[model samples]
Target: MSHLNVNFLGIPMASPVIGASGTVGFGLELADYVDLKKVGALSGKGLAPTPWMGNNGVRIAETTSGMLNCIGLENPGAPYFLEHYLPEVKKLPTIFIANMVGKSVEEYAECAAMLTVPGISALEVNISCPNVKVGGAAFGTNPKQAAAVTKAVKDASSLPVIVKLSPNVTDIVSIAKAVEDAGADAISLINTLLGISIDIRTRKPILGNITGGLSGPAIKPVALRMVWQVSKAVHIPVCGLGGVMTGTDVVEFMMAGASTVQVGTANLADPSAMGRIVNELDEWCDKNNVRDVNEIVGTLKA
Candidate 1:
């Protein structure tokens, strides 16, 4: 098997294949089905300064080539995660990343500070949350607001911060550059595209939140383009996700300049997606005569 090891923001990963946040549910949930050790890292569900029950009514809806989710960052809050979740997560051999989201800059900083535990390898700041301080626009949509959030979280946490940028922005490159300049250690792009689904019969929305973030193969192309663009504009490592369902998709993301790729919606369809992707990536590398996976990163011509 070809070597699939990757150094993601100074954290050693056995493979670049990771279980994306919101899909993996803290590494241990899928441990029974897939060998967690074989995977590179597990991005836990979005956590806030306080626990949330999530949005009421329909939380998920199916689409043509994707799915919409309005889970609303439902979790037991940061304190519970540090006390309970972190201990068990520590038992897993792979790297552990805590996905942090907040309603404001202070909450974001608080969450980041709380997640600075020994077992956690990194912090993935979900900039998709609304910036209550700046009306309702997402912190990631504006470069200044995004930088403010990044600076706040970076100041609070000793662990490397990976800011997850939203694809909803008008110009993703600007947001990526802003976060990078604000001291983000790494970047993860194409969080989810704003989408809507309505029931024709009842003349009503499908999701309780009326609008939800779309994921799956439908957004892969857009995600790829943004990852390629941002990777060129920034110096930090880029982690790519969106509609990744196969090993070939993993190869494509890496070729486009992603240091690593995350498995999101695919986990909902197939529990073994991450492990399968890791194996498939190794096979693809060997067949292509590539000895190291890192060689494929940013290898795109022109």
Candidate 2:
């Protein structure tokens, strides 16, 4: 039998296919359509210290092969998650990761502390949100700020911390190395590339936020390249995500350097995507005579 099991930051996962945050909201809603246990893990929607109303107007728009989202990390805040969602998610037979975001270092740390309860398997620090205290610059864009946020969250969170990297950075390797140095247990890369769409006839922006994060098959190449680079640069494990839509794509990522992979846009396209990927991965491994999925990680010949 193919062994699909892998440990992410010491958190055991039956499979390496985790439901990306913002795509799988707390894992409860998806339970009806999917078998929660079949998924390796489910990351909660990005949460903040306080509830956010999110961006106004059209927050999502369709592009060629992907989609743009400026949802602004709309969430019910840390306390609500701990009280309402975490308990339900814990009942599921799958790993649970809390994706946390904030406008300031202190807020990130505070939310991390609040979400560090026993049920949470790990804390994923989302540095893609703008840092209002720092001139609205995204924490992940600056190596120094990324490191600072990682350090602060790591200090406050008892659970293992994973710093989610933004694709907007000029040097992803440098930022990945910085987080590694700041005590991040692992890293997830290529959150989403900034992009925009226009309605020519109306001569107006497609999304209310003007610019939004682009995700889908359109970004797979960039995500793979960054994952390969960051994986080689940092000692921590790298979870790759971009436009993965099939089992072949997951295998490609694992071979490139991803210890694990997240299914984001695919989930939006199909609620059963992650489960299907898991089953497909097993079949692929069996056909290839691969015994352990972990063996494929970072095995790229280069």
Clashes of each: 1, 0
Q: Which candidate is the best by lDDT?
A: 1
TM-score for candidate 1, please give it: 0.98
C-alpha lDDT of residue 296 in model 1: 91
For model 1, state the Cα shift of residue 241 in Å: 0.5
Poorly placed runs, candidate 1 (over 4 Å) = none
* Tens-digit lDDT track of model 1 for 1-302: 43888889889888998899999998888988787777889999999999978889898999989999999889999998888888899998899999999999999999999989899889999999888888898988999999999999999999999999999977999999999999999999889999999999999999999999999999999999999999999999999999999899999999999999999999999998888888888889889998999999999897
Can you write out model 2's per-residue Cα lDDT over 155-208, one digit (the tens) per residue?
Answer: 997899989999998899999999999999999987999999999999999899
RMSD over all Cα atoms, model 1: 0.9
Clashing pairs in 1: 216-243
Residue 195 lDDT (model 2): 97
